[model samples]
Target: MIKQPSIVIIDYGVGNTQSVANAIKFLGYKNVKISCDFNDIENADALILPGVGAFEEAIQNIKKRNLVEILNYQVLDLKKPILGICVGMQLLATYSEENGKHEGLNWIKGEVKKLNLSREFSVPHVGWNDVIIKSKDPLFTKNTDLSNFYFDHSFYFDCYDEQNVIAYCDYDIKVTAAVQKGNIFGVQFHPEKSHNNGLKMFRDFINSIS
Candidate 1:
């Protein structure tokens, strides 16, 4: 049998862990491991940081598990591809002003801020919103339709380098929906819960590992 891609679904004690793993599995990436162990993550072909909840707490948990250095080593030093989803994506930036100012992984040049929008759209920006594709990349294609995925967040990434922004969504304002900087990637939307469209994204990410 052809060997499937190996993806490590990082278990930082937050977010939709199993579902993300399940989604990858559904995409034929059977060699999926959900773990906080440095060795497991370090050895994986690609990493998936699936996170939900507050920014500070998530960073605290990642630090508590001693995953910071290993993650940096693997993703930065080793140049392994990593995908951060939702709050996980926010954590990839330098800082986030969710509850208060909190330090992020600094993997990408960006900051997280609450959705500053007019009364036309709600706070969370819940449900399905169109993804305005900004760039053509292997991870997020250029031909992708705007209304392709699901979103559930109040805060979003404000990138310093506009060139890194792969796509975005509008909710009275242009919100950062996805970011791609070299080997690092982040999605403000939840692909795991986005049905078939999400599955296709999963396939793209996993297939790009080799």
Candidate 2:
């Protein structure tokens, strides 16, 4: 039997690390852990950067923990696949306009900006919404329904290059739902909260890692 890869949920003093870990555990992947230690992060087969907070706060925490360099090395140099969720996904952009101009990991070429919508639409685009898949990325399979992924955020990733965006959600304006750049990947929605579709995403991500 092929051994399952060791997946690490990065705990950089921010994000819904526990909930993400729980979701992964629920999928029966026993070789998983939540840690901020550089050694553990470096040793993991794949990484999950999950967040549920302000963009500035998340980036600050990541830098405070001194994770920026290590993460860059792992994902960029080693080509290890990493998934950034919500604000975690926003962290992948070049910078964010939240609170102030803050620097991000810049793993994907993009900028984070607040949603510009009319009074009819809400600020934080909460609840379930469907995504329009733009690519044949393995994370989002064909058979799986592309609707009803949980989303809760006011800011969205604005890709500098449209090719980086794999999926989009229409909310007055086109909101980037998912992005992929070689081994790096990110999702604006929380798959952990999206029921079976979410679980399938986690499963697909795990399977995609070689």
User: By lDDT, who's the top model here?
Assistant: 2
Any runs in candidate 1 off by more than 4 Å, and if so which?
none
Q: Lowest-scoring 10 consecutive residues by lDDT in candidate 2?
A: 139-148
Clashing residue pairs in candidate 1, if any?
Answer: 131-146
Best by TM-score: 2
Local distance difference test values of all predictions, in order: 0.87, 0.90
Q: List, residue by residue over 1-210, the lDDT tens digit for candidate 2.
A: 889899999998888999999999999999999998999998999999999989988998998899989998999999999999999899999999998899999989889999989899999899999888887568887324466699999999999999999888889999999999988889999999998888988888998999
Q: What digit string (tens of lDDT, one per residue) describes model 1 on residues 92-195?
A: 99999988899999989889998888887888888988888876556664237675789999899999999889888877889988898888989999999988
Of candidate 1, the 10-residue stretch with the lowest lDDT total is 136-145
What residue pairs are clashing in model 2? none
Give stretches of model 2 more than 4 Å off. 142-145
Q: TM-score of model 1 relative to the true fold?
A: 0.96
